[model samples]
Target: MTFDRQDLSNETLLHLYQHLLRPRLIEEKMLILLRQGKVSKWFSGIGQEAISVGSTLALEADEYILPLHRNLGVFTGREVPLGRLFAQWQGKRTGFTKGRDRSFHFGTNEHHIVGMISHLGPQLAVAGGIALADLLDKKPKVTLTYSGDGGASEGDFHEALNVAAVWQLPVIFMIENNGYGLSTPSNEQFRFKSFVDKGPAYGMEAVQVDGNNVLEVYTTVKRLAEDLRENPRPVLVEALTFRMRGHEEASGTKYVPQSLMEEWAAKDPVENYEKWLLAEGILTETARHSIRETIKAAIEAGLQEADAVPMPTADIQEEIADMYQPFEAPVTDAPAGSAAPDKRFIDAISEGLKQSMERYPDLVLMGQDIADYGGVFKITEGFVAAFGKSRVRNTPLCESAIVGIGLGLSIKKKKSMVEMQFADFVTCGFNQIVNNLAKSHYRWGQNADVVIRMPTGAGSAAGPFHSQSNEAWFTHVPGLKVVYPSNPHDAKGLLCAAFEDPNPVLYFEHKMLYRSMSGPVPAAYYTTPIGQAALAAEGDELSIITYGMGVRWALEVCQDLGVSADVLDLRTLLPWDQEAVRRTVEKNGRVLILHEDTMTGGIGGEIAAWIGENCFEHLDAPVRRVASLDTAIPFAPPLEAAFLPQQRLREQVQALRNY
Candidate 1:
């Protein structure tokens, strides 16, 4: 272990040189294709090849990794075919992920690489989750993650590190400190002496190394990998490297001065590794030339293969295109079971959670103040008493970690229910939700049976952050199922339905109505169908399409204003109530979509357009919408009154009256 270059064997030297050259040649070939307009675009990992290749070699076969956009070296090492990589760049059928994922954001089910995401910081939490699973299952595996120094600034990066450190998870966070993050230099991004130093604050081991020296990276990671395999815990390693090319294919060297480029060029990892191999008598001139020739041939062959692969068929595209597949709603004559008496919305959620927990023993619920505190809304009250701490547990005030752990548990095939203390604090775990849990099933096809309970919506003067309706954000994503329940019956039914669904569901329970709202629920244990809509009224004049609390508001307005408005409550957003909407528009001949969300690009507008396109002849009047103004939810009572659509405003019946 003494500091001596002589300690390295010729075989080790040759391997390092070969690894460095692999990515370099790939980068060169990618750029050539880019110039020829054969490949769409690429983010060159030309200079940072050693960092990816060496860091990846450090990982065990069964271990996990969350690579960034620039880590093609890792993909190559993982045995992802060069043809698939080329196909991805060319946006062809042969591409991994069927050309849906980015060129660098590749995944392989057989290889166990979960895939890359464009979002910067969320991978930290996802990696932590994988490591958490290893800890829980007593699996001898580590999750190695690579994020740039710029990505280090993301709240998720800090949050993930803190969670993993506290839990002593088997995660190795490798920061590829390439001096600059796109245009911003390290001096501007951070004040720390080194990114590695941040690890100690989170109660984890830290190390920094010459990222250019593939040997240094390999040695550091190899030791850490062994440690993780034995006694799994968190470790942070910062590799000082450089980006030889522009940030992306669209960018150019105009941003970087020639002098600075020339300075870093002198220490090229590919060239330096080659020199090191020659000095160690590992790789001679002939072998080096042969390796280069081999890589060149492989890349050319891959491109040719990629060019030949058939594009995905339009039929296949049409089949999976719609993420939100509305359930074929069953005929709703009263069930053969007796209806349960009225119960509080809160009570219904608690009952459903309890029943769900009892049914699925593996399902665990964790969040702050959830144990004795029973959650801020008391929805999870008495859960700890029944299931104990391991299953029904209280957590630290780290939202990221809470969701991260839930994700890990879900991937391990344990159903998980993670509640944000309040919908407001979900911003703390936004990265985990938006990037990891939401896309887990779509990206990896690893069924993430997780439900995120978010108490959201306005009217209780909880101010802008706490009372905001934020379902629009989750609805935009393809894989997630967003649900909002307006009453106890729907809440219980939808909550139960969420637990039964294979995809991750965002179960948003409006806190304002939780204790107040009560309705008739069936006594029997059953799961309400997801993606189905409940028709509140039969009307011919107009269709008031709504969901969540909007359903209640619309019903009230319809009764008060004497408007023949047919109201529908969509219990799910991803697989929305498309048929219900279609039937209502067909019957009513007029559509007036409504929601509490902002008017711009809200679900209401989407539904309106769908009806307009499909049921154009059914219209008696122009389709209208009543929604919150396109502004942030206000804090003051008066301003908030103006911002949110009042029931009085919706009561006008003008959209129908005008018809």
Candidate 2:
């Protein structure tokens, strides 16, 4: 409670108290709307309002705030209109999310707030990335991230905090320890004496505050915020509070002990703070009463306005379609077909990344062991010295957090590229990639312009852990674009194309083809069109549609058989060359879609289905597909090769050609 007395004017004190009560009043209004059948569901932070309000008050206007579903106070304090909050719940287009989401899930870049999704742990790393970006840009700012006790248990939580601590990021990790995580009590949730103690383990300053005491929480955060701005380092704050209500209104407090609830109720944050303010002569009773009355009036009017706001008509489609709008490239193709020397696939990709970074100073490359050691594959060799450690960062082995931080950096107008050590490990950060990074733009009109370089496909006997082709996982997500290039030229071109695109993209560079494949690649800056397929070979008998390693295999098979078959290399998988396939099938009348991933749910299946639907009449035969066996990638060379279906692809193609 050491904040300057001069700074603690009557207006400031009154505002603090009002902030503590605002969320509760809003919750009550939302409940009334729900009862009136105006809205659907809500997740209110009844007892956690004090920490939400106080923590937010410590932040400056320029800093970022990443709040979970319960941090309504943080949103309202950041000047998010309560009417918009109601509109989101009511699915009205006037809401911040434009009726795309229901719940406290919208954010505005102008407000310096990125609202949390259902999985709250990822936001911690995202906030840390923002803080890291601010430090790099020499901006005097800090990011504050919030999570509940339950969210703290997630691996993302640990990874994010560890990165923040290691980098000494100007980020504050605040855990609202609400005694219980849903129905699970603290005693059953963890073995630690207190959540604050965990911070020191990660080299962060740890403090446990009386979360119910608004003044204590505010002062603690203010001091930490000031120190962070001066000497940037992450801090951990555990605000010990109680749920007061169940996880949601429908759940009720049946699980919470009545005795415990009553005991905590006696220490109501608002009532106690109001009493202290009145006694200290900081807040007059009349003024305090007026503040409450004004807030109540606002809540009533805001709810009404939200209810009347109509659902968006055609706006969402317009926005989704706008994603396809092309950005004017800073540099175009080499003057009219200037020939460049051939480069290795690995070298081509590295060169392409280097060229893109040079063109856009804000372009960043981040991953594990990517600095001094270069990378597991050396794809970013000498990148640290060339781009500086700030741009070519060596992140900890926190997969999800790395992607999450990349997301944060991406939204701040910095072009970020994340190197997933291997495609298999991307699963660690699946929640962030699929939920936040992918959908952030569609949900809140914020650009998560991130390119994740996934060194994928198996042939090195590197085992299941290191080798995987998980492009289909991303292709399935609505907001993500998937790219899997087969050769040196396409690897360089498609990767650069991903950087230019203003949405999240998964760039799968086949490890099997990295050193093995070599072809002509332009030295000049250029982007191969994203949705187009490359016609590697042409003929009249059959069509072989494939991507990545499969394209090379298809070429070898068609040539060895001496069959007059057309070969199409689908360089970009998600926005796969649908038109190219249609044309090829129409001409050849027989087609085979192939890939390296497992058969049951591979991208080949999607292509096969599309062909079945779109070009059924043109088929001289059934559209065939070839993929790896439906199981974990075996470790043995013989087993792995057999599992992958590489050797047998030629036979399958031969049989189809003969038929």
**Which candidate number maximizes TM-score?**
2
What is every candidate's alpha-carbon RMSD to the true fold?
3.9, 2.1
Tens digits of lDDT, candidate 2, 200-282: 79988899998888777888899899988999999999998887777877888898878999988887777778778878888
Query: Looking at candidate 1, what is the lDDT of residue 317?
Result: 54
Expressed as tens digits, the lDDT of each residue in 1-659 for candidate 1 is 11234476766666666667887888877788788887677888877887888888767766777788878778887767888777877767667555555666655656656666777777677677777666666788888888899888877787788878877888889999987878888888999889767877888899998888777888889889998889878899998888887788787667777898898898787787777667757778899889889888988898888889876665665436433223343433336867788888888889889988987877888788898889888888888889887677777677886787776676566788888877878888777777777665544456567799998888877777888778888888777888888778878878888887767789988887887788887765566677778887777677787777787788788777788777877777776888888888888887777788888988877888888788899888888888888888888888888887865346546646675
TM-scores vs. true structure, each candidate: 0.86, 0.96
The per-prediction tally of clashing pairs is 1, 0
Q: Candidate 1, overall lDDT?
A: 0.77
User: Once superposed on the true structure, which residue ranges of model 1 sit more than 4 Å away at CA?
Assistant: 1-14, 254-263, 282-296, 310-341, 361-366, 388-414, 425-448, 522-524, 537-544, 554-566, 586-594, 598-601, 616-650, 653-659
Supply the TM-score for candidate 2: 0.96
Cα error, candidate 1, residue 608 (Å) = 3.7
- Model 1, residue 384: distance off in Å is 3.0
- On the 0 to 100 scale, the lDDT of residue 384 in model 1 is 82
| Residue ranges of candidate 2 with Cα displaced over 4 Å | 1-7, 312-316, 319-331, 337-339
